[model samples]
Target: MSSKRVVFDFDIAFTNGGGIQGQDFRLDIDGDTITDKELADYIVNDMQLLMVRKVDIINKHYITEAHKRKPVNLKADEKLVDLSHTIFDGLVTYKGLPAPIICDYLSREQSKVNYEEGTEFQIGKITMVTNTGTYIDCPFHRFEHGKDLSEVALEQFADLDAVTINAKDAIEIGKEYFVGKELRNKAVLVFTNWAKHWNTELYFENHPYLTGEAAQYLKECQVKLVGIDSHNIDDTRGKSRPVHTTLLGAEILITEHLCNLDKLPENGYKFNAVPPKFKGAGTFPVRAYASLG
Candidate 1:
């Protein structure tokens, strides 16, 4: 198959300044063979640019040399720890919520007819509630008219200065744990070690959780996000979810069922728990992790 060609212009910008300045550039891509979105992603990934804000097509003819850029290398001492549980077929994340029904929407064997020899693909699908696995909660999770998952800003969920408060063996975490700590614009993760019982019958029982006063204190400190490695941020046995109500009411994001907190230091790391941009959804699972510099 021959590759189609197209010329385009783009305005690139970096999240941090002093990088490359925004400029219009032309490029030739296989417009007939590749989708517009794939071509745009190629420009960003190949150029090593932070974000592609705009793309305008100029022409759809003539081929040119594909621009190449080197990929960023990780530092020698940098560490990344996964803090989320893997979602598997028929695996229970929460007690009452139905387990995710993982299956192939399009089987690999069936796709052989659509592609050339030896080419196959599998398209999988999952059906589950938003609260399954390690999930994040926005204001809409608690309040009727509040910021949903799509409404929350990316900065609120990613690349935030993080600190973990180890409260192992404590069932109720109180405000005293964070009395004098600096928490403004930071991801405050509470390490309770309760995640050790994950995927077991004991995980749904009485587990460690943050108290109402602790949530209130975090709200007062303007914390960007709050997370805990436990069943729920609030005591699930009771009807009043004060911890969720207090924090979400103040627009503070929350992440639950996180693991691997023991691998992270008390400070000097960045935390991220970003979910998909699903409009009208208040809660969703995230691939929570921490980057240690």
Candidate 2:
């Protein structure tokens, strides 16, 4: 039996600068009349995409409809919410109690004579393990010769195209799950319903993980990065972290412990999870987010 599909349509108006609509920028759903049925038909016949039934134009209004025919560049009132959870002291400390003592204080001595009426301070330091909070593991994290955080290019971790694959119903995300899917040169994010355990002890246990075969498939496809809303990308029950091994060995990065993944629509938002630019650090936390307009 085929899975049931549904399509929800809503009209959106976008302008640049303030309220001026640009003629050069057009959102053409297969050169159709921008209706739901035609857009859905285009996805089915032209792209061979599935799970989308139809697209319909729910409403339309000219800029003049609101502001008396004034041409100003304005964007549709869209909000960008952060998807990454905050990093606190001992928030996501490893199970073995190697948690770092995260504190906020001045590293350098404060000015002694400058306490009259001015503000004088020193730089602060946040000491912690490389694998704290929502972090990404580059190739060098698992292998000695693999690319380290410095070795990995900015494009690999930043905004290179991204797509999210929902695996909510599957028992495991294996190679077969990725078959017939285009993954080459894309950031593949796995939504496994694991973000619910962000700060709970259960997050450190045997959570949903990507299988080795899935890793191999992504490797073959030359995926730029792989992210999961789970504790780790590998099966926590096993000693061998095969998923991390396979993907990282192929120079693919791994982002773990993501949150708010459900807010993003599959295959729409651009994924970006960037770590700090540091030398010799194999892993570090990031502010992972998605941009939608």
Candidate 3:
């Protein structure tokens, strides 16, 4: 419904030094009116410009046009939806675990000496636990003798039929939710909308989780994978984690901290959440997504 767009010129000065300018840029606004503050924030965030000190919006005007950047053309049989959170520096996935320390090992400016004129590259380094972002658990996570990341078959985590169980406003999801659903060999993603509280203190307190019975039911159904859009798949209150034990013990993969499940339909889709094949590792982050027709 937002057909309004703004065409404007802007100059942004960085806090450190140097500045950049743009002209004749068209941005779709949420409504017919937009202030300079919102436009400046949008430009800085949309461009991912670091160290922005000030933004000057100039020659601004509105126009009625379709948003160019939002529309895409895809075949009727192909549509992909992202279901993972972006991992960034200082993002706390869990309370006790240290946030990821991401920094550039070889920066673009430093690479100039080794390259021909004007050729630059950046090599980044990340130091964090495997369970930093939206991650999957292998059987090895709970059992020492179970398969590790490198040993699990690709069919276990990639391109599998999937379903979404809606547990809106429910704190403890039970087995009743899955009694009539076709869950066998399907990646069942539970939508509790808990991701809306991510990056906040509330996200870690009394979050939605699957009860032990739910885990047993999914295991009995021989589900390929179980994903949740919450702080965790199982309750984090006590020292016990029956859900993880029940599911991963049966070789059913578990993907936690998944987002965007509300955008998916009930069924008739393929889910993919493949982690890097790391030897001796039990868990690692994944770029989870759903392919729908």
Candidate 4:
């Protein structure tokens, strides 16, 4: 489906307060035509304004321009690409960390007793450390006084504008790799092609990592999150972890052990990586994905 947009003027009245109005405001729409009620609902949901009592649309027109956001359906051009490593029993992410243990809490045969005849269901249970697979490290992972997973707002992990940096053959990625790039308020993912050696012994040796200068540069740029398709984001040969220290100290989130990064373009898409809400936990696994159209 081709991208379509609506241009119109709107007068909105609040449920208990003043009113708001707009002229020539543009918005993405699903189809070529839309009812005024549906358009009002779209504006309310997208803008996230207060309660609206009623809306009046005027001078409405449709255009065939590119979508700034989204209002597409399954038959449209929007696509969702997975950018995480699948975790199963005995799968190692880090060198020293243990693998996840997956089992069934209630088997189908055992669940049959809880329900009527010919009806059954199964419940699964998993036991593993928070950082077992492709995981995110919040500020609390390094600083005890920083925000935990639950304290981090949901907006930080939803519909975030993102870009990818291709560093396929480099070992020590420096600030030069990230210089002159749009790095502010976006999830900058570094594609290292190191995922080719995933699940192999070579994956744990001499993996790609960001240098101290690069970490400091990203921090200075005020990037929202940093991700790498490698085993570790910091050099593991020594005792010090300067990359994690610098970035996490500034409250910049980190995501390591990412996979399928090559499927994403350098820009023009959104990134979402959300973990289960956990209190007092710093790092946890996430099913990260990229959205594009």
Which is the leading candidate under TM-score?
3
Ranking by lDDT: 3, 4, 1, 2
Top-lDDT candidate index? 3
Whole-model Cα lDDT of every candidate shown, in order: 0.83, 0.69, 0.91, 0.90
Q: Write candidate 2's Cα lDDT for 187-219 as tens digits.
A: 888888887877788777767888888898899
lDDT per residue for candidate 1 within 126-193, as digits (tens), equals 99999889999999988989999999999999999999998987999999999888889899999999
Candidate 4 local lDDT, 119-167, one digit each (tens): 8999999999888788999989999999999999988877889999999
Better of 1 and 3 by TM-score: 3
For each of the candidates, the C-alpha root-mean-square deviation to the true structure, in angstroms, is 11.3, 13.1, 10.8, 9.0
- The reply for model 4, stretches above 4 Å from the true place, is 1-78
Off by over 4 Å in 1: 1-78
Model 3 TM-score (2 dp): 0.75
- How much lDDT does candidate 2 score? 0.69
TM-scores of the candidates are: 0.74, 0.69, 0.75, 0.74
lDDT over C-alpha atoms for residue 287 of model 1:
100
TM-score of 1: 0.74
